[model samples]
Target: MPIIVNLDVLLAKRNIKSKELAKIINITEANLSILKSGKAKAIRFSTLEAICEALSCQPSDILEYVKEKE
Candidate 1:
């Protein structure tokens, strides 16, 4: 996938655990784990907003686009 999920890295840099973030964001730990593992196919705007709010970060902090070389 071109879009890489960097949630784990940001969480680590911020010294926050997955369960802590999930609790603060009101999301299930399993769902957060899926996202952290980059196995999520899509994310809701509300969920994204909650994550950003809870982590004190922006969407760009969690999501990155990598262009493939042809």
Candidate 2:
């Protein structure tokens, strides 16, 4: 997966716990964990909006694309 989820880094930078973020975003911890771990196949725009709103950041701040080494 070339797409990286920077949720954990953002959380750490903001001094927010997963539980707190999940609660704010109205998502379960398990689901949040999946997103953070880059195991989620997709994410909803509304969910992304909520995350950005809560974290005071943008989609680019949470997601990054890296080229895979061949």
Candidate 3:
């Protein structure tokens, strides 16, 4: 996927556990795991907002775009 989810990196940089983040964001650890693994097809804006708020980060910190070589 061109869009990469960098949730794990941000979590690590903030010294936070996935379970803790999940609780802060009011989501399940399983769901957060799916997002961390880049398996989620889509993320709700509310969820994104919550993550950013919980991590004290901008959306760009959790997501990135990489152009694939043709």
Candidate 4:
């Protein structure tokens, strides 16, 4: 996927567990894992807001665009 999820990096930097972030973001641990693993196809704005709020970070910190190699 050209879109990369940098959530794990941020989570580690903040010393937060996936389950803890899931609870704070009001999402299931599975869903959080999906997002964290870059398996999610899409993310809602509300969900993004919740994640940002819980992580004290911006959307850019979690989502990044990577150029695909041709």
Predict model 1's lDDT versus the native: 0.94
Q: Candidate 2 local accuracy as lDDT?
A: 0.98
Show pairs that collide, candidate 3. none
Cα TM-score per model: 0.95, 0.97, 0.97, 0.96
RMSD of each: 0.7, 0.5, 0.5, 0.6
Two-way TM-score contest, 2 vs 4, winner: 2
Clashing pairs in 4: none
Where in model 1 is the C-alpha error above 4 Å? none
For each candidate, the alpha-carbon lDDT, in order, equals 0.94, 0.98, 0.95, 0.94
Best by lDDT: 2
Error of 2 at 40 (Å): 0.4
- Cα lDDT tens digits, model 2, 1-70, are 8999999999999999999999999999999999999999999999999999999999999999999999
lDDT, model 3, position 64: 95
**Across residues 1-70, which tens digit of lDDT does each residue of candidate 1 receive?**
8899999999999999998999998989999999999999999999999999988989999999999878
Instruction: State model 3's lDDT.
Output: 0.95
TM for candidate 4 is 0.96
